[model samples]
Target: MTMRAVRLVPALIILLVALTCASLMIGSVSLSWIDLIKGFIRQDQTAALIIYDIRLPRTLLALSVGFVLGLSGAALQGLLRNPLADPALFGAPQAAALGAVLVLYTGTVEALSFALPVAALGGALLSVLLVLAVAGRVAGVTTLILAGLAVASLAAALTSIVINLSANPFAVTEIVFWLLGSFEDRSFRHVAMAAPFMVIGSLLLLRAGEPLRALTLGEETAESLGLSLVRERILIVLGVACALGGAVSVSGAIGFVGLVAPHLVRDAVKGDPKAVLLPAALVGAALTLSADMLARLVPAPTELKVGALTALMGVPFFLAIIARRRGAIAADAS
Candidate 1:
């Protein structure tokens, strides 16, 4: 790592820590530092319940899910050699949401706690498989992206159909709210359920780092260097499916952290995709925690969905990136 990257990591870690603490403190009834400490000590039962049972899991989910999204995003960008690549670009989130929606619609979510996430994971994996099959073994980036888009559209349409055709108004309401995405009232069970998948997915993505570096030199060159494009592609798809799939299973469709996080830290990492992974993940954690805090603080008694806040923050950045890339292309053509 370069000096800039070395500096960036610590900076991001500090920011993440601060945001985590803030997330713990900001909620319907904000707690002071003393209350937070007392809650940790278990001296204040009310504060303890609020902190441990309520806020902690939400905070943990924000951090882990954000990290997974960022890491997956960086890996995809590297694998595809596209700065615009996001975890959701492959339709994992939408398909995962569809899975959860099906569970909710079927009323199985009430009977089985694991049903939602399991269904979501199945959906996410299915989307990835569809993308891979449609793109074919020797497909290029454009083909893969197109395949992803098609799958995503189909999944989304199905999700809407499920929502529209639902007979139970309560289920529809619950599904709609869940789809909006929030860390509200999430328990440690959610954290535990999603943790393993996220960890495995993260490891898989990290393993792609060296190959991604080789890929930067072009696929033909990387293949000449003895890299297996097929293996690399499978590794990335599975990693994304697991990591992002797990995240979406728990958190619904929290958008743009994957897309924005990598760009924020790419410059500090000297545009090295390998170096970008860790820092982008840190940035992603910070962003999610910060957004969660804002979602709590902004509306006070009426909390905003964490996903909504992220989209509001991320959309401008996304547009700016597109404009910057457009300008660069124009300049190149000139």
Candidate 2:
């Protein structure tokens, strides 16, 4: 690693820690550092109840899901060689949300234990498989992107329709909340459900970096280096599906962190996707935790949807990137 990159890692880690603490402190019932310490160390019941039971899960959820989104984003970008690629682009989160909604709207969400996450995983896996099946039939990056985009649109439409058809007022409200995505009222159960799947998926995706670099030399060269294209593709697709699915199952449909996180650390990683994963994850954690904090602290009686804020920030950033790319294309054409 370059000196600059090494320096960047520590700074990002510190920032993540700071953001996490800030998040823990800013809830409806504010928590002091001493109280947090007393809660954990001295087992003060009320302080412990508020700090450990309430805030910790949300903080952890934000951190882990952020890492997963960023890691999956960097990994997917490496796989597709497209910086714009993200979990949302592939329909994983939308599909997962759809799955959760189906279970909820049908009145089975609570009846079947583990139904919410299982259905979500199934939906995400199905979407990934569909995208892969379609893209595999073609022979280019453009086809892959188009396939993912189509699936995402379809899944999102289906999710909206499901919400629309829900007769129960409470079910409709729940579905709407999931679509907007937040970490509010989250618990340790959510953390437990999401963390393991995310870790497994992250392990699989992190392995892609070296092979992805080899792939930059072309399929023939990468193959000659013993990189199996089929295996690489499967790992990344499955990895992203699992990580993103787990995240959405717990947090609803938080977006843009994946698309934006990698770019935040691209300079530190010197555009090497392999080196980008860890830093992107760290920055993503910091960024997401900060966003969640802002969502709660925004002075509105009701908290802002974390998803909405992310889109507000991310959409403009995405547009700016597109504009820059357009300018570059025009410059090249001239």
Q: What's the TM-score of each model vs. the native?
A: 0.91, 0.91
lDDT of 2: 0.81
Query: What tens digits encode model 2's per-residue C-alpha lDDT throughout 1-334?
Result: 7778889889988888888878777778887888878877757788788778889999999999889888988887787666877777677788888888888777765722466777777788888788768876322545655787899899889987887888876777777877888998889988887777788888998878898787766667778999998888888888887787788888888888989999998987788878888888887787788889989988886789888888888889878886877755454344
Off by over 4 Å in 2: 132-146, 327-334
RMSD to the hidden true structure, all candidates: 2.8, 2.7
TM-score, cand. 2: 0.91
Cα lDDT of model 1 overall? 0.83
lDDT of 2 at 309: 83
Clashing pairs in 1: none
Clash totals, every prediction: 0, 0
Please, what is the whole-model Cα lDDT of each candidate in the order they appear?
0.83, 0.81
Task: Mark the regions of model 1 whose C-alpha exceeds 4 Å error after superposition.
Answer: 108-112, 129-149, 327-334
The model with the greatest lDDT is 1
